[model samples]
Target chain A: MNEKPLELIHGEIDGRISATEREELRALLDADPKLREIRSELQKLAESFEKVQPLDPPAGLRARILTAIRPPEKPAGLAGWFPAWPMPTALRYGGAVAFGAAAAVVALQLGGVGQGTPGMDVTGLAGTMARYQEPGPAGDISAIQLNLNELHGTITSHLGEGLVILDIDLTTTRPVAIVADYDSGRLRFSGYAQTDDSAMSVTNNDHQIIVNHEGPQHYAVFFEGDAKDSVEINFRFVADGQQLHEETLKIPLVN
Target chain B: MDTDNELELVRRCQKGDGHAFEVLVGRYEKPIFNVAFRMLGNYDDAADVAQVAFMKAFENLARYNPAYKFYSWIYRIAINEAIDQLNRRKRNTELDEARLPDWHTPEQAVRDTQLSAVMQEALMDVKTDYRTVIVLKHFMDCSYEEISGILDIPVKTVKSRLFTARQLLKDRLADTGLL
Candidate 1:
């Protein structure tokens, strides 16, 4: 077969040949048995291409993404009585101003400084204690604050021992615990709150606390002994919960 | 329900409405992910690339000219992202070595597992550039023009690539005496 005829046959199999070209190739195939065989081979190859199906993605990818884009806790159930309005308008602008003012007031009280010093520095030591005590109108302690000093660290109460921390350092929201186990050393660290109640413990030579969840969450290092003097736990908040946040502290062993 | 509704959703999404975008994403997510998987040959990479493409499309919805079809715009983004992922994998030696088995039979009574195995091996033997075009054309059933648009290649280039892809497949199969 000539180069042009072979190319035409390929084009026909690929659905790329013009109508006239297809006609020509069809005629040639009808006239020659050998060319017909060549056409069959090309057809098989094309059909084989169709056999490969697209596989499903590994599970958990979608949930991780949706969680990432979720907004701050405005309200839930009957508490969300405010009007839902479209963005880029007067209502959005007004909402933004209102939110800014409320944030400023909270910042000032926590920062331990006057309103003149760039609002409230509601972070570090001052904000940690305030956030722990005040559970907000939502009746949920959205997050916990940890005071990691050079030698010692303080974990604010309200984050119970059984609760697991899935993430830390989230903006304006606390981390949710999907699982918890204290015996296995799976403890919710400072700077986050637990949401889920799932927990497990494994008693091997070295007891391991395994907190299983469908998604990523915060965790802290712990030792297997009641003697706290030999164990030092370091914790940090993560941005996406997958990446560790820059701010971190080591909880010194209480000897 | 139709293209008009889809376009309306897109318009709503462009105005910073997340719900509308989520709806649009829900509608096209499966097909887009399938296309990405076929192009990239890896499930994890395809999912990541598809998600990124949707997010990018959402972020730049205003820049999307209304004259073009929505699928065309979104698909263009997906194809480019898939190709970029393929290239990045090649550079990083992160190409998923996991091979997907095929399911084809000659008797047409039951799918031939053996044939599927042979076909998968044959496909892996072909170069990535050729395999991508073949998958888009045959598996996805994209028209030549659509393929050309997605890949950002001329119509003639699409033809040439498809032709070469077929030739490579035939040669591989013939070597295995599967022809």
Candidate 2:
């Protein structure tokens, strides 16, 4: 009846009890018929669980999953460029990226400097930026911190292995959607991930990635950066189903 | 597979090796599927959850920390997905009658033993948190420490939840006269 006796019974059933603990449990059970009866009921519960078998996965489940994630096949005649990630146009989420140029294009377009075009609900990503100047590693870019009262965090870019990554970390009270619009001409959306397990979903295409979630989060958006000229990445933050803020960060290779 | 073997496959997956990922999928698909099935009590939903969990894992392979065992990470993802599904179903008011049949008879109890018996029904009655602990402890054959690691809870909490879940399940079965 006491918590101690019940815990001991579970520990005994789980085979996690020590010799001394076992002896202690034995003495306690010997003194209480109710405890012994309870143990028998618990043992039956365990047996039922054991008798229930694991269900087999459906056949070809593995193949279906593999095909979904396989490397995107390049369309014919596009030898130099691969148009990977041509996702549903219906979910034309925003695309944001400022990387993969021919030179040190320091086009640091923080929000309000010049209103970069917002992502597609109808309008294509358009936004003006300051002239390119800052030299970054592997054509990576960075952005100013978000200014939303409910949302707070900095968005920075890291580049490696032909991928330009946006490391977005934010803590928010209300639900927020981070829309990233990059130059489809220069990059293809590679992947999106949260730093830890959190409630988040991504809508992505070759040019844009939109991440929706609430609470503290560390999100990364990866794109295969392959721009030779100049490309811009615009990050738009939306809340309550409305665009609240937009900023830009890009690194261009002018080589 | 051993930890080293799993780690090697994961490393290959991180580098975009499809074959290596296939091996990892082969190894975990059934276990993950079963885990989801127990939580959802529906094969179709469990299949979708298992597939989606794997896709999420595959997409984030670069973020997989080798220090943690591969199965632990995958199991965590599966459990989270199942919990999310449970919450979504709650929000949508989608009720599975089998889980909560308004009528029950002694004959039905006899016809439906084990998988269809009072234990399965009772498992669904407990809170998701408690059911999760039970699934890990009983169906998954996990030790308290193992459940702690997978659920990312303290070992003490694992013990507490498991004990309470067992009691709750037992009571539900007793109420149905199947104990």
Candidate 3:
């Protein structure tokens, strides 16, 4: 038999040889003791290299990440069930003052009146403002309360120059708090959550919103606007001392 | 899962589906983590680097081409991340010269808890270029062509580096009376 190529044999041992070369190398290895010895040595080293066990990640690493990527749970009460009303383009771009003023005008045009219901009373302009002020003092503003029964949904709005959206749909229920500050043209947002007694938070100050949640909940918040401009919005929610669920709306105004 | 199913998962993940990405993570975490841990001697650092690499890969999934192997792409990312981490550690003076022991005897290594750890220590002491070639060839069991694609190096360079790494390892092992 022709002498086997040592390089080809080495390549085969190292998994570098081509198929045809591999076949040739294997045949030669089957016949040669010395070549087999070298191959065995290389194989041992390679096997040893592959046997190292990877260390487990830090206990909280996975939870920390999941918290960051997961969405938040809807606030408990009426707001949870209310469909997220998209902020009007004028309100999102024109500034909070402008948006509020526009909203006032729209409210006036739409009769600027409050209607009452059996479960809750929502009557009179004063009552409407009161509901906006207290949110659920009479437990009548059930629409603004988040439903704990269904924990899957997204809330979207335009904050400053960009859109702001939050997604809350996961098996785990973690209270999430989002705060947005459009004080400047830039938007800032922060998210916080707690999982298994551990708390995690992520903040994007530029976007003016903070997302805070606990557990395996999933959520998202986005902001867009030019730097050096400012807007203001109100975020409201109640927590059981352990967590908070709040949302802030930035109303733009042209000074 | 089937390759077609895996491809679908990748597509869903690229479309910003976190659940889909999570599925992908579950499927490849072990293999990816193994590669990183082998390439990097420390388990903690390897795990951190692997997680970060996977997150980064997911974030940039839009840039991934379906035509290439997903495993290769992820492996490349993990390798690059590990190398970058090593460079950062060197710059920060975090890598201690004292931490690296002289090569051990092959018999000593064999009698040790696991020869992998000894080999790992030896590999860590080598130059980054040589170390990577050795890892791709031995630990990952990658073909020269596959290594070439992942590292963007020519096949000849892969061959030369592999030969150099193996020769150096052999010399070091022999000197330690471990061969």
Candidate 4:
């Protein structure tokens, strides 16, 4: 069979043919009775497909699906979801962003990513922008999940562009201050910022940072994770000047 | 939902919002299940594959690219799952070719059963690659471009696959005295 007419036949049946192509198809059918037969057969084929009945999935399938995801499946070593980690190829070329002074820090606060969906107490995600646009190294990903009553989210460490980016996505019931203390010997503090427009104030004094904010917020803190062994950072969660909890994180600087 | 809302739901899901994931599942489960039914031809297998597809989608939400439609991404997952199931069936049965599908349903009108059975057989006769295009185009009501996106193939490849699939279906139907 002539490929062009066959192509046009499918296009016309699919309702994808332009006026010019439809006219071309008509001429082809006129030139050969076999092409007309093929076109007729295809039209009927489509009509038959229209009669394919849709069946309902078995009962309880939705429940089963949601149950499978209640814990949110993760890879073998990680316990939570991390956002916008780069592909290995892209990560290989990632230029780590490093700062001159300070080291790694972990600041605990009450906040969710961008939304405070009830029943789940984890800061969702700060919306990792697409990977190609963000520079990140091809290295290990470490994440910690928090299910605190006041704050729910994940703090994730990603190696990229020669810097360790700690992503904090969370929601807070009240105003919370995140106090972070880092050793200057193992790492360098690059920067920190909230990912979206929410009221926030941050204070840093070389060895410590105190961030005060309220509601759902997402942010990133970058540090030079170039230490030979690992980096540890201490965090103090404070609400209205009272400490709520404390956490310390040790990240192997293995990039 | 609009594209903006859909993207927002996806974003929320990535952020660990179970509600957002449920909303997405509610919106797409029916069509995805139907696509699975058409591809696999067994209601039970279709249900299993559809459920697994959504599970995989949830597990990999973080790696999803926002540049494409969320439905496209999920559809691609569901279709790929269906194909994988088909391959496993082949390996277990050691069949040289796919058997005629049993598409019977208790709710189906008796009048339509013969035609539906014939349609199922014709569908199973086509190769998986072509069967996928047919399911996306005819069952899922997708455009050629949408089909291309779901299959991760060029539009040209989609057209060729659709054409071949239709030709195969038409020839089979003719053999069965349906056309």
Q: How far is candidate 1 from the true structure (C-alpha RMSD, Å)?
A: 15.3
Cα error, candidate 2, residue B171 (Å): 1.2
Cα lDDT of model 2 by residue, A107-201, tens digit: 11112212333322211212111011112333335455765787987777655435565667788778777777777767755444344445444
Candidate number achieving the greatest lDDT relative to the actual structure: 4
DockQ of candidate 1 relative to the true structure = 0.16
Best by TM-score: 2
* Predicted model with the maximum DockQ: 2
1 against 3, candidate with superior DockQ: 1
Q: Model-by-model lDDT, in order?
A: 0.48, 0.64, 0.50, 0.65
Q: Model 1 off-target regions past 4 Å? A: A14-23, A68-165, A168-255, B94-125, B176-179
Among all windows of 10 consecutive residues in model 1 chain B, the one with the lowest summed lDDT is B100-109
Model 1 CAPRI rating: incorrect
Which residues of candidate 4, in runs, are more than 4 Å off? A71-255, B94-112
**lDDT digits (tens) for residues A13-96 of candidate 4:** 888889999989888889999888888888888987787676666444564355335433343232222222322322211111
lDDT, model 3, position B103: 25
Give the per-residue Cα lDDT of candidate 2 at A113.
Answer: 15
Of the true interface contacts, what fraction does each candidate have? 0.29, 0.56, 0.14, 0.59
Greater lDDT among 1 and 3 belongs to 3
* Model 2 chain A: ten consecutive residues of lowest lDDT: A96-105
Give the alpha carbon lDDT tens digit for every residue of B1-179 in model 3: 37678789889876666677777776767666666766766544565566666656765788988887787788899899888767755863522232224322233245345455557667777898898888777766778888998999999899878877876776666555556
